[model samples]
Target: MWGRVRKSWSTVRDAFRTERDTGRQARSHNLFEAAAAYVSACAEDDQERIEEAAGWVSPEALSFGVNELACRAVIALARERDESPRAVARDLLGLPAA
Candidate 1:
């Protein structure tokens, strides 16, 4: 009797797990893709794309992804321009050099 109960519980758990996985697979884009879309949208100044990207993920996750992208971009720009990341960022923003 105990063995039967344990087997039934395992079957139920596996069924729920499969359902959750299927739902995840149905999502149009994952967090990383959303982040990339957000960065591209920002670079292009496309409000529509930005809004669409934001809707793809939780706000906190989106924010983290965007922050990571910005950090990488600043580092790349600084390397390309042979300047500090702060300087590169300021230059890009048309700010007076610090």
Candidate 2:
């Protein structure tokens, strides 16, 4: 009987752990989505959308997301243009060409 009770408790504990991990993953995904929204707003030059996205996630998370998006964009543009990522980034920022 004690063995059965122990097994049941173990099952419940495993379920709770899974649920906790799932919740954490969902929250991280939601933050990333918010960051994507912020990046999209920046591309569109829409201040309203940017502000809305800022409200959805913490500033640090949003900043990290924005940086990640910028790096991805630079890499994609570099590949498409057959140029270095540095050149692509500099051009996007209107910096002097190297």
Best by TM-score: 1
Off by over 4 Å in 1: 1-25
Candidate 2 local lDDT, 1-98, one digit each (tens): 99999999987544322221444553323456777898888889999989877766566666776788778889999999999999999998899998
Tens-place lDDT per residue, model 1, 1-98, is 99999999987543322221354564455556778999899889999999888877767667777788888989998999899999999998999998
Candidate 2 segments whose C-alpha is farther than 4 A from its true place: 1-29
Give the RMSD in angstroms, all C-alphas superposed, for model 1.
Answer: 8.5
TM-score of 1: 0.65
- Among these predictions, the greatest lDDT belongs to 1
